[model samples]
Target: MIHPLDKAPEQGEAGLLKRLLRAGLPVAPTVAVALEEEFLRLANLQEQIGLLFQGVFGARIDEERLFYAAERAESLVRESYLLPERAEAFLGSLKGWQGPFLVRDSGRSPFAQARTPQEALFALKRLYASRYRVEEVLERWPRLFPTLDLVLVQEAGAPQEDPGLSLKAAELLGQPARVEAWEGRVVRVILD
Candidate 1:
């Protein structure tokens, strides 16, 4: 059973029909009542259709997958509310992480000028196992960049440990950062 807050009177029911009537539907109120009943039936059918999906997919669906899918669906629904009018400055704040920067270096602190963004990001994920947990990091990153577009985080280029940039990250993550660079090669990051 769904909590009352999670339930609606089967959308397009009596209340909806009454609302339509009040909003100037010429149909009789009895028609509204019929529509409401029909809508409830449709909702029941929809629920059955969802059950059918679960039955067909059940053999392949594990509890973890179901939980993750449900969580993702809920998040999508909730995130839809974060539009420009509602989110304002609070939107970009998601990008700020309380943890350390997940740097993606190519094992060389100096840029090879050959490493692609994809390669760099992959390397970063490999270097920092804890930070690359995409879903969790993403939740925080939205505060920095509000779009649900994952590319914003995916395209953050490669972060290298440079004196200046390290200082920036240190200030941002609020920790003393030990700058590591390949000897004789300066650490450089292309800031987008």
Candidate 2:
């Protein structure tokens, strides 16, 4: 879903295709619009895939897991235009949460993964500035084509939180169910 930098503005629908001309420079088309497009892209993907996933799996998937799988998981990968460009690594959600998060921005190249307040500030800026879920265009990010490569929102590293909420006890359906994880975070489900 990648388009050349020169032509990105024209095809505004495909935000994933748009690339920042210079990684060091401020994000093109202003930071606000970029943010809108980013969230719109995410929300749209959620809309398209969420329905299908719920239909097949018959279980609700969290926004974090859906976005992560859309970006990284092999089983969830699909050649859909609703997806982000490979040029941009999928950073997980950045909204409705608190601090102590490690934002990964592997835009063009990799750099020191500073777990300092600097990265957190950058994410906060994106969170506050970008206008993604608005009734608008083009999105916000706080995750623009700036120096950021990946935008992380959940537990850093591969590990995720598992409170061991039993499906049998919660659902109370007496149906067999299983929860699976990748590197500790729950990623898959099996129900019978």
Candidate 3:
């Protein structure tokens, strides 16, 4: 289900995004598509992972074969489209909002990559497809499967003088560190 940013779900990327927003950071309005929806779309693909490996290597699949199988599965998922209802919900959430929304994978490294409806769609698919990437398979296969639980669609933030801000949790010299970009370069780091 699609949940508004203010009502972000209790777990995963949605929660993190909400916390970031609540902290009064300059973030855009966001909505999170729950992990359950992604699980539904990807359960079949996950199930096919072993089969694909077996079909290629006759049941004794090595790391390379497993990776290849995962890649195949990711490709298939990339080819598939989001569920109709989810798509509708996504589009509906954008009502009254301006154009050029940014769609990001909540579970992965964040980026404001989508600037158009078509680009957003492709970004969403790519987010889902990232679950099956070779590195992902090498890291998570046999222990965990990737889930499509969190797609964050937000209003594209206007260009700012600062490129971005990054907070470091571990104390840097006994205090929290904040990195800020100035004039497109990391010119200052404040310890608070």
Highest lDDT, which number?
3
lDDT of 1 at 80: 28
Stronger candidate by lDDT (1 vs 2)? 2
In order of appearance, the predictions have TM-scores of 0.20, 0.20, 0.66
Q: Say which candidate scores most in TM-score.
A: 3
lDDT of predicted model 1: 0.29
Ordering by TM-score: 3, 1, 2
Misplaced by over 4 Å in model 1 are: 1-79, 90-157, 163-176, 179-192
Model 1 misses residue 29 by how many Å? Answer: 59
Per residue, candidate 3 scores C-alpha lDDT tens digits across 1-192 of 777887878666456445555665544666776544564445566556556656433346476776778778778777766767767777777777665566666654354566665566667767777766777765764544654456777666332324244552113223454443323322223344
Report the lDDT tens digits of candidate 2 across residue range 14-60. 12212212212121121111332454355454354344334221245
Query: lDDT of each model, Cα atoms only?
Result: 0.29, 0.30, 0.58
Q: Candidate 2 — which residues are off by over 4 angstroms? A: 1-114, 132-155, 158-192
